[model samples]
Target: MSIEEKVTSIIVDQLGVEKDKVKPEASFVDDLGADSMDVVELVMAFEDNFSVQIPDQEENNIRTVQDAIDFIKENQKA
Candidate 1:
Protein backbone atom coordinates (compact mmCIF):
# COMPACT_ATOMS: atom_id res chain seq x y z
CA MET A 1 0.00 0.00 0.00
CA SER A 2 0.97 3.62 -0.46
CA ILE A 3 2.26 5.77 2.37
CA GLU A 4 -0.96 7.75 2.44
CA GLU A 5 -3.03 4.58 2.79
CA LYS A 6 -0.75 3.20 5.45
CA VAL A 7 -0.83 6.45 7.39
CA THR A 8 -4.60 6.65 7.04
CA SER A 9 -5.00 3.13 8.40
CA ILE A 10 -2.79 3.94 11.35
CA ILE A 11 -4.83 7.00 12.23
CA VAL A 12 -8.12 5.19 11.72
CA ASP A 13 -7.04 2.28 13.89
CA GLN A 14 -5.45 4.41 16.59
CA LEU A 15 -8.36 6.82 16.83
CA GLY A 16 -11.05 4.18 16.15
CA VAL A 17 -12.43 6.10 13.22
CA GLU A 18 -13.50 5.28 9.68
CA LYS A 19 -10.92 5.06 6.93
CA ASP A 20 -13.08 7.20 4.67
CA LYS A 21 -13.05 9.91 7.31
CA VAL A 22 -9.29 10.39 7.18
CA LYS A 23 -8.80 12.90 4.42
CA PRO A 24 -5.67 14.88 3.63
CA GLU A 25 -7.42 18.11 4.52
CA ALA A 26 -8.86 16.70 7.74
CA SER A 27 -7.39 18.03 10.94
CA PHE A 28 -6.59 15.42 13.54
CA VAL A 29 -8.19 17.31 16.39
CA ASP A 30 -11.12 19.03 14.70
CA ASP A 31 -12.11 16.63 11.94
CA LEU A 32 -10.68 13.29 13.07
CA GLY A 33 -11.77 13.69 16.71
CA ALA A 34 -8.35 12.89 18.04
CA ASP A 35 -7.59 13.88 21.59
CA SER A 36 -4.18 14.38 23.18
CA MET A 37 -3.83 10.70 24.02
CA ASP A 38 -4.80 9.66 20.55
CA VAL A 39 -2.06 11.88 19.19
CA VAL A 40 0.42 10.22 21.55
CA GLU A 41 -0.62 6.75 20.43
CA LEU A 42 -0.45 7.77 16.80
CA VAL A 43 3.15 8.87 17.30
CA MET A 44 4.00 5.60 18.98
CA ALA A 45 2.38 3.70 16.12
CA PHE A 46 4.34 5.68 13.58
CA GLU A 47 7.58 5.06 15.48
CA ASP A 48 6.85 1.34 15.63
CA ASN A 49 5.84 1.13 11.98
CA PHE A 50 8.91 3.02 10.86
CA SER A 51 11.31 1.51 13.40
CA VAL A 52 12.46 4.98 14.27
CA GLN A 53 12.47 6.71 17.60
CA ILE A 54 10.70 10.06 17.60
CA PRO A 55 11.80 12.18 20.48
CA ASP A 56 9.30 13.95 22.69
CA GLN A 57 10.24 17.36 21.42
CA GLU A 58 9.89 16.29 17.82
CA GLU A 59 6.53 14.65 18.44
CA ASN A 60 5.00 18.07 18.96
CA ASN A 61 5.80 18.95 15.37
CA ILE A 62 3.71 16.12 14.03
CA ARG A 63 0.17 17.38 14.02
CA THR A 64 -1.03 15.90 10.75
CA VAL A 65 -0.86 12.65 8.76
CA GLN A 66 1.46 14.24 6.25
CA ASP A 67 3.84 15.15 9.05
CA ALA A 68 4.01 11.56 10.19
CA ILE A 69 4.56 10.29 6.66
CA ASP A 70 7.24 12.86 6.00
CA PHE A 71 9.02 12.01 9.27
CA ILE A 72 8.97 8.30 8.48
CA LYS A 73 10.16 8.80 4.94
CA GLU A 74 13.03 10.87 6.21
CA ASN A 75 13.93 8.74 9.20
CA GLN A 76 13.08 5.16 8.17
CA LYS A 77 16.19 3.05 7.73
CA ALA A 78 17.46 1.70 4.46
Candidate 2:
Protein backbone atom coordinates (compact mmCIF):
# COMPACT_ATOMS: atom_id res chain seq x y z
CA MET A 1 0.00 0.00 0.00
CA SER A 2 1.04 3.58 -0.53
CA ILE A 3 1.95 5.85 2.34
CA GLU A 4 -1.44 7.56 2.23
CA GLU A 5 -3.20 4.23 2.30
CA LYS A 6 -1.11 2.92 5.17
CA VAL A 7 -1.59 6.07 7.16
CA THR A 8 -5.32 6.01 6.58
CA SER A 9 -5.45 2.37 7.59
CA ILE A 10 -3.61 3.13 10.81
CA ILE A 11 -5.99 5.99 11.59
CA VAL A 12 -8.99 3.79 10.95
CA ASP A 13 -7.61 1.00 13.13
CA GLN A 14 -6.48 3.39 15.85
CA LEU A 15 -9.64 5.46 16.06
CA GLY A 16 -12.19 2.76 15.23
CA VAL A 17 -13.55 5.05 12.54
CA GLU A 18 -15.01 4.12 9.19
CA LYS A 19 -12.60 4.30 6.27
CA ASP A 20 -14.83 6.75 4.48
CA LYS A 21 -14.56 9.17 7.36
CA VAL A 22 -10.80 9.30 7.36
CA LYS A 23 -10.42 12.11 4.87
CA PRO A 24 -7.07 13.80 4.44
CA GLU A 25 -8.44 16.99 5.98
CA ALA A 26 -10.13 15.28 8.88
CA SER A 27 -8.75 16.21 12.26
CA PHE A 28 -8.02 13.36 14.62
CA VAL A 29 -9.78 15.03 17.52
CA ASP A 30 -12.35 17.32 15.94
CA ASP A 31 -13.40 15.06 13.12
CA LEU A 32 -12.56 11.57 14.37
CA GLY A 33 -13.32 11.79 18.07
CA ALA A 34 -9.86 10.78 19.20
CA ASP A 35 -8.69 11.69 22.66
CA SER A 36 -5.17 12.80 23.57
CA MET A 37 -4.24 9.26 24.56
CA ASP A 38 -5.57 7.94 21.28
CA VAL A 39 -3.44 10.47 19.39
CA VAL A 40 -0.33 9.30 21.26
CA GLU A 41 -1.10 5.70 20.42
CA LEU A 42 -1.66 6.65 16.80
CA VAL A 43 1.74 8.37 16.68
CA MET A 44 3.40 5.31 18.18
CA ALA A 45 1.66 3.14 15.62
CA PHE A 46 2.87 5.39 12.82
CA GLU A 47 6.45 5.28 14.09
CA ASP A 48 6.38 1.49 14.34
CA ASN A 49 4.72 0.97 10.97
CA PHE A 50 6.83 3.47 9.03
CA SER A 51 10.08 2.94 10.99
CA VAL A 52 10.53 6.64 11.68
CA GLN A 53 10.94 8.70 14.79
CA ILE A 54 8.22 11.34 15.20
CA PRO A 55 9.45 13.98 17.57
CA ASP A 56 6.93 15.38 20.05
CA GLN A 57 6.96 18.79 18.38
CA GLU A 58 6.26 17.23 15.03
CA GLU A 59 3.67 14.91 16.47
CA ASN A 60 1.81 17.90 17.83
CA ASN A 61 1.47 19.23 14.30
CA ILE A 62 -0.11 16.04 13.00
CA ARG A 63 -3.73 16.96 13.54
CA THR A 64 -4.92 15.68 10.19
CA VAL A 65 -4.49 12.37 8.38
CA GLN A 66 -2.58 14.08 5.60
CA ASP A 67 -0.18 15.46 8.16
CA ALA A 68 0.79 11.97 9.23
CA ILE A 69 1.09 10.83 5.63
CA ASP A 70 3.30 13.76 4.77
CA PHE A 71 5.54 13.27 7.78
CA ILE A 72 6.08 9.60 7.04
CA LYS A 73 6.70 10.28 3.37
CA GLU A 74 9.26 12.94 4.18
CA ASN A 75 11.01 11.05 6.97
CA GLN A 76 10.84 7.34 6.12
CA LYS A 77 14.32 5.83 5.71
CA ALA A 78 15.29 4.21 2.46
lDDT of 2 by residue, 6-77 (tens): 898898898999999999999999999999999999999999999999998999999999898889989999
Q: Which parts of model 2 have CA positions greater than 4 angstroms off?
A: none
Write down the lDDT that model 1 would get. Answer: 0.84
Clashes of each: 0, 0
Model 2 TM-score on a 0 to 1 scale: 0.97
lDDT of each: 0.84, 0.94
Give the Cα error of residue 69 in candidate 2, in Å. Answer: 0.6
Residues 1-78, candidate 1: write the lDDT tens digits.
Answer: 877888888898889998888877777888888889888888889888868899999888887777778888888887
Taking all chains together, each candidate's TM-score versus the true structure is: 0.87, 0.97
